[model samples]
Target: MSIWWSIHLRRDAASVPLARRLLLGTMETAGVDPDISYDLSVALSEACANAVEHGGDGDSAEAYRVTAYLDGEKCRIEVADSGPGFRPPSRPLPVRVASVEDEHGRGLFLIQALADHVHIGGKPGLGGTVVSFDKLLKWREDAPLIAV
Candidate 1:
């Protein structure tokens, strides 16, 4: 069985946990390993947090979209928002956000560390950034929705 879901959420701090809880519940019902579920949830939180923080510069978008797919033996997730798309440096150097006192920059790296595969890009017409990632799934022994 395959499971997929997508939701458009308000770009607010409260939306982060709402997305996490939904992901966690889906994983739990699907009998995904708890550890893997936790990892995915954490990644989702970071992605959602990023969307809330940058998805709208308080002028353009008021919401972000999050999508998840559980297919075969792997699970893929994506978070996208309508903002002034992410622009990378010419040389791709690590950037420090705002200042040393500001808590930022580590979220994307943490997502990369947690997920097996990660992709970052922008949606052209939407004028926003898209962060998508995937990881191999580990199932509980008695999982009802075990991937074939």
Candidate 2:
């Protein structure tokens, strides 16, 4: 069985949590485990946040789009925006300095580590950025299996 969903929201931090909840709930119905839920949510939130922060110019009407698909044993998520695309930074981001104690610049890094596959580039023929990730869903041997 395949499940798909799409959302468009104003580019802002407030929309991030809603996106996560929507994606996570959809994924649960598709058999994603709870342990991996946070990882998926974090990766998606970061990608969407990047799209909003970098793509949207703090305009309330600017729209950010998120699409999710579950195909059999794999799940894929894509976040896009109406604003212009950007080339991701090539160098590693500097760690938080002891004196600074900041909590930023870790989004892309977290996505790279969590996702089984990640794609970041300009959407073809479109100006905005599209950040896509795919994860391989794992099944617990002890849990009841459903054959679709």
TM, every model: 0.88, 0.83
List the lowest-lDDT window of 10 residues for candidate 2: 139-148
Models, CA RMSD each: 3.0, 3.0
lDDT of 1 by residue, 17-106 (tens): 999999999999999999999999999999999999988888434989999999989999999998788774344335444567867777
Q: Per the 3 Å backbone cut-off, how many clashing residue pairs does candidate 2 have?
A: 0
Candidate 2 segments whose C-alpha is farther than 4 A from its true place: 89-100, 140-148
lDDT of 2 by residue, 1-148 (tens): 7778899988878999999999888766656676666788999999988877887666867998999987777779999886778875565435443336656777887887888888887877878888898888764444343214
Error of 1 at 116 (Å): 0.4
- List the pairs of residues colliding in candidate 2: none
Residue pairs with backbone atoms closer than 3 Å in model 1 (clashes) = none
Candidate 1's C-alpha runs over 4 A off are 59-61, 88-102
